[model samples]
Target: MSTTRHYINLTNSLFPLPGYAADGYARIKGISALVTTFGVGELSAINAIAGAYSEYVPVVHIVGTPSTLSQADGMLLHHTLGNGDFNVFSNMFRHVSCVVSMLNDPHEAATLIDNAIRECYVKSRPVYLTLPIDMVQQKVEGERLRTPIDLSFPLNEQEKENYVVDVVLKYLHVAKNPVIVVDACAIRHRVLDEVHQLAETSGSPTFVTPMGKGAVNETLPNYGGVYAGDGSRASVRDRVESSDLVLSIGSIKSDFNTAGFTYRISQLSTIDFHSTYVRVKYSEYPSVRMNGVLRKIIARMGRLNIGAGFKPNNTLPAVEPESSAQTITHAWFWPRMSQWLRPKDIVITETGTANFGIWETLFPADVTAISQVLWGSIGYATGACQGAALAAKELGINRTILFTGDGSFQLTAQELSTMIRHELKPIVFVICNDGYTIERYIHGMDAAYNDIQIWKYKDLVAVFGGVEDKTARTFQVRSKTEVEALFSDKEFSAAPFLQLVELYMPKEDAPLALKLTAEANTRNNAKA
Candidate 1:
């Protein structure tokens, strides 16, 4: 509602900037805004905008266009089509965005802008607005800017909410073993506190999907591991599938999220809590949203039967005491990284190996994990890292870390320079595995299409306008010992300046979840 000017880091490409806005919104818990020029600039960033819409991040896209007189006169603007139609680009955004507003009229511009942003927040999707050149200078009422937009959701009807809560309680009271499965929308809709209270108060085994990595506190006693049907660890999968009731919160059952539609839980045994509705065993209650319903359920629930519900097995698989001389593998790297992560650190993972590999990581309390699991956009994490770092800096949260693959990093590597210009310090790990490992798993294991040119990734800091020892530093860790040594280094761990590590792993190596998901995808593709 209220706008403030933050530091804008200009980048070479428009593609990654919207990604920055997406994660910035996540970190700051508010709608993030980005501006683009008409047609070309807006079109270039549409992919990222669609990714935001897919992943439920609220972003406001303001586009600068030609003056209204020019449009009225049918003058062909350089960025527009030859036919002089300026609405074409905005039309394309309608499919992805929840709201699109064109500010051709100066009188209604303020109201349109406010309503657009409100819709963006309420729906947790992107909104598109266009401002022409002459309209930009027109005097609008400053009185409206004094009051902030009302971003609160409409209150659920009291009778319907109580009835829904009562029905949910009935299920809870009679159920012997009920488990909670948190997913991506729980984070997107800002319902973590309600989710945490429900999980802790109910004492049910709580698990996260791959997309819901950091939705709940992992250190809790009832914290089960990530559940993605067949892709899950055997103990976790069996525990969830055998449960009498499953409370699925804010779930997005995408292909990768559900391990290619392999979820075994039946609708009869499941209750779904979404942003706008709540479902209990086959019956759904519309206009009964999750935030209030969860809060009411926790309040009304006096006791839970929870008979013989298995305790969460949070123990990481034991590995042989690794030496610095040993080669770094996914099995060793992921579990070790869990130990390295600090509380409240913001960890951003790329859609390649890091996204799937992160399922093994048991995050400490308040750690924020950001990734595009549903959208599955490559090279998004790097640009998101910049925006997250900026938001982190503003909020006084230290240590924004990024884990990206070599191939994916190359797509938006220029954003690193933007971080350098803004003097934001983040620990970046570029997993140099030679090619697109995820693609290799699904299709060709050794095909030419999967290969990428090798770059000295460590040299990128200097190439991107970063000073060697003052503003930035770089390192290459080839073995487990090297990784351990770097992690143990006080200077590196302190994250005083921008740091990039070329983390070398085998080209053919992949996380367990990725392998399982790839196999499922392959089989599904062969079906029809």
Candidate 2:
């Protein structure tokens, strides 16, 4: 009955890639409802659901199960544990999801469904719901449907919030040099307006973590740069590290986000705001939530203003020429590709080379850049591109651009078929380097284990049901000159159809940041 109601919104997939589907839904900030058959189908997507949980993307995994009678009779059906324990999958889901529900009674179905969905939005994490085959035709009362499930924000203690704000004010007022650093939680928690308000009102140099790149506007006058600890540009590192006070919002201090814990900041001068708490030096305010606290601080901006002695010099220095000769390099491609993007374009970058290389490019305002820096999952961006494109379509936006390496693309490239099926127009740029450049940089630079079987990437469009000059088109370019012409070309840039650009680069070339971090990671791995 539920499927019948939303049949128009439904699209069947070739596999149970809940990971890809969940990752895709995460990009658009939408709730995913993935239907899978019991055991075989459900387990296929369990790993993806776990990824979604780690990244705070909400997805409802609905499982169609065997008959209730089979469970009662202890019948060892296909796709079961053979011991008649059908609860194993449900038990596993409890670890990854914030909520789990099963429809056993028609009278309880409506409330369970509502409550599970409410938790999904409130927590912003995946949920698991199970439906026995026998419950498929059950009817439930609609009386409670009028009252919407309460998904309102939980309030922190007003007194505690005020106390934290005053402490933050004291630090802000005395600091000669102040800066604002944003992280992933700022994007997920929906307090970006508050982050922007604080930065604008404070007139501080603002920078984003690797995960928080597109959350805040980077074109502002006081914008410092991307702050990835030692991996940051020299000027940005100097300004941020040398600051008298650092106000970090939604900060996730992961190894990747912090460039292998390379950040050097005095905790005494740092005020950290998170989704549910705030930390000032050694003192932790447990109930002081960022959403309410940030909103309150923005409201009191006039009184909290700390004028004079705090000025940020935002200058963008150009890197040296990527190629003295006419060769396509990582440094060269990303910077040039920057100008090719338009406003409101959703850009998804895969892990490894694309993830690291994209940091060099300065994104324009209103252009969203999506990448799994913290997850560091290869092949995620392709599936995420599918999600972003569909989300853009629903939101009436154009252009879903994706940048993925050859190794990662090969992992989940089947998602392109889904995009073609749904008629989503995304311009996919597959970085065709020979092997895993990131793995090579980390351990064995010349190991055969780092290599992959190369496929004719350009021919995929035809195999995936993409018609030339109609729903899809493919391009393979090998040189700087050809890439320059394609990016500069008005028609190609528009990409009115689902387009693929197989970009061939040097087998060993990697982003400068990746090379540095790979060495650090190697040392860390050696220690472990």
Point to the candidate with the largest TM-score: 1
| lDDT (CA) per prediction | 0.86, 0.79
Candidate 1 residue spans exceeding 4 A from truth: 1-13, 18-21, 24-28, 307-316, 322-325
Best by lDDT: 1
Record all residue pairs in model 2 with backbone atoms less than 3 Å apart, i.e. clashing. 19-48
Q: What is the per-residue lDDT of model 2 for residues 1-528, given as tens digits with 9 covering 90 to 100?
A: 022111012223335444565567655754667777888777877776777787777777788888878878889899888998988999999999999898877888888998888788767788888898899988888877666567676888888889888887777777777788998888776788898888777677788888888877766777766888877877788888888888899888887778777889989879899877899887888877888888776776564333232233322224535334556788777767767777788988888888888777777778788888876777788887887787788777888899999999898888888889989999999999997998899889999998999999978888999998888988988888898788877877886889999999999998777887787777778894
Q: State the lDDT at 306 in candidate 1.
A: 72
**Positional deviation of residue 376's Cα in model 2 after best superposition, in angstroms:** 2.4
Clash counts for the predictions, in order: 1, 1
